[model samples]
Target chain A: MIEVKNVAKKFGRKKVLKGVSFTAEKGQITCLIGINGVGKTTLLKAIMGLTPFDSGEILINGEKIHPGTYEKITFIPDTITMLPNMKIREAFTFMADFYNSWNAERAGELLKFFRLNEDDRISDLSKGNAAKVNLILGLALDVDYVLMDEPFSGIDIFSREQIADVFTSHLIEDRGVIITTHEINDIEHLIDKAVLLDNGVILKEFDTEEIRENEGKSVIDVMREVFQA
Target chain B: MNVKFNNRDPVYVQVIQHFKEQIATGIYEPGQEIPSRRELANQLKINPNTAQRAYKEMEEQGLIFTEGNLPSRITSDEKVFQRVREELILEAVGAFVDSIRTINVPLNEVLQLVEQNYHKKGDSL
Candidate 1:
């Protein structure tokens, strides 16, 4: 499990995350939802130790994140970080060299799943294919947790659906996932839990199925009641 | 296998309801093998944990059973099968009565209309 306890961060004069707390369990998908500039990415970055947090603690399986934690957790940013001149195969090679957790076979399977020719240059791929490659880079790792940042934001509907299909496939394989998104329409049924964020604070956190079963309200309905209020 | 799930209901409950409907209609035969939890999740485009919950509920209710290491199968119990059909019929009739009563329709008139439409629809199908 990944536990974020009272984690807070500040950038110059603006506070990005204020006392954010949540637990994402193994084999479950937890979503962090908020509007733009609400620090969703900042929180994910803080968990991955890519960015510094001013206070509080983040524990992975009850231990503070250290240098070796990279092998257990990975962060897939919204944009592809590879060079435009690199081919998909070359990018795979880059990942293979950088991380000991990289799974070449799973990467090959993901290439077929996304229906992309790895020989195609990154510069020549469409926006949706590029997103698939970006996701593949993170998913192909043999890690216990994956943190994704707005994977569906700028993709086409079909591409968005293909990405959503990943949650149900064996490719995800019982790993804990923390996904941040401003838009929830495409993945309303795919997530196990939701944490609503606004103005650097958590407004609500609840199980999706529990709300639907007990209160007869969807995630959006609760979001409306909380955010609108 | 396509299920257009509503947002307001628990997805696991919806899945159980779907299985009940299929069993009642004989679409899923007795003792027939069903998809694994992961396969069902992919088929329904739902969370795998939700699929697991639905399967667990079904197993507890005796609607399905697993033996040893084999995949789960629909229950072959005749009593449970009959109960599922009867339960679905009662629930559908109850819903129909509730809506029809609100409109102030007489029972005889409602029964006659139901009889007429039911046969017509069945014939057309």
Candidate 2:
């Protein structure tokens, strides 16, 4: 289980998370949804300890995650294009070295499912293939939590379907995954819980089923109503 | 598997049933690889994630498995396939039974109609 207790973060006069507290239980896929610039990425960074929060505490499995505990979750950043020097194979090695739960078997299985070759450099790959590699690496980790930011930002329709299937097949049953993305149409049925952020605060929080049953709405429909789009 | 995204129902469950029916009818043979999720979603014109969810449902139910570098294939174990096929027939027949019962049709009349249709279908085949 992951917990964010009264978390608050601010920059200059703008407050991003205002005492926001929530729990993402094990074996659940919770989506962190908000429009662009609503601090969805910030919340993910904060949870992963990549960003500093002014106040509030973060916990994984009931233990406080302080300066340490960074390895409990894998963070997939939005702009994940690392230096072009490393080949896709080498990049996987680097990540595997750091993560204790790195499963080479699962990783290789996904790469083949997506038809990605290891010899190709990360920079040499096309946008679609590159995104597939990025998502595969983040998801293949056997850790308790995985956080992804806009995983499908630039992916094409065809690639999206193949990559999404691999993710679902490989997701661990008893772990928490937080994905921040604007692609609600793709993930609405997969998300068990959703947290909608607006102007640096949680505008709405509910089970995905609640929205469907009560409003007969998809995640996109909820965004239209909540964000007034 | 073609999955319909309805607000009140889980899309993955629908996908699982679709695969079960196809497999039972020999549309997809055991050990045969199914279409990549992108292909299925493109054919259906829905979100790829929905297709992914469907595949996940199949794996959890032990009807399929993924081989590295290969597409997902139906499980070859007869026990698993037989169980899933039986479940599918029951679900299918159960729905028909409920509908017929709702209209107050007699059970004996339904059985007689089934016997007539069975021979007629055999002659056509």
Candidate 3:
């Protein structure tokens, strides 16, 4: 399990994460959900050690996060991280050279599944295809936990559907997933737990299935109640 | 596979309901092989863990059975199939009765509607 306990981060003078804490368990999909400017992305970066936190602890399986921890945790930032000039084939080659955990066979399969051409330039693809490439880059790695920031944001409807469908595929099975998105409807049924963030704090955290079963409420319902008030 | 699930219940529970409905309606024949957990999850666009839970519950209820390492199949036992059909019919009847009660429609009106609509549907079939 990946645990974040009271993690706090500040951007110069403005605070982003104020005592944020949550756990993402292995073999389950945990969603970090909130409206805009709630530090959802910042929190994910803090867990990845890409963005340093001011206070609190971020631990994976009881060990503090370090540089080597990158092998076990894959973080897909909200924006494209690959170089614009790189072609899809070159991007795969780059990843294969850098990350020992990268699986070329899985990357090949995802390339076909996403209907992407290896010769296609990263800068030449549509926004939807670019997001698919971003996802394929992360998913092809054999990691224990994956943290995705706004993966469903600003993409075409068809691409959103395709990305959501991958959550159920064997490509993601038996691994922990932490996804942050304001649009929750696309993955409502796939998420196991939800951590609602607001104003740099975790407002509430609960099992998505438990809310549906016992309260007859969905994640949207809970979000409405929490965010509106 | 494109089953429209209601949001009020756990997704896994709804999956099990869909499977039971398929068996009761003969859409899935007795002893027919069902999709693997991963295949079901991909087809329905749900978490694989949810699919696994649905299959586990169905196994407990004797609705499906796995042989050794083979994929699970709909239960071939005659008694189990008969029970599944009867249970579904009873659930539908119970729901119908409850709805008629809520609107204060008398039993005679509901019976008439059921008889007329039932025959009309059968004729179309």
> Highest TM-score among the candidates is held by which one?
1
| Full-model lDDT for every candidate | 0.92, 0.77, 0.89
> Top lDDT: which candidate number?
1
Top of the candidates by DockQ:
1
Model 3 chain A: lowest-lDDT 10 consecutive positions: A164-173
Q: Please, what is the TM-score per model?
A: 0.97, 0.68, 0.95
What's the distance in Å from true for residue A147, model 3? 0.9
RMSD of 2: 8.2
Write down the RMSD of candidate 1 (Cα, Å).
1.3
Name the candidate, 1 or 2, with the larger TM-score value. 1
A7-109: candidate 3 lDDT, tens digit per residue: 9989989899899989999999999998979599889888888778899998998899887787888988767789999999999999999999998998898
lDDT winner, 1 or 3: 1
Candidate 2, position B56, lDDT: 79
Residue A158 CA displacement from its true place in model 1, Å: 0.6
Arranged by DockQ with the best first, the candidates are 1, 3, 2
lDDT of 2 by residue, B1-125 (tens): 35566655555555666778788888888899888876665555433555677787788778899978789999998898788778888987999999999999899999999899989999999
Q: Runs in model 3 with CA error above 4 Å?
A: none
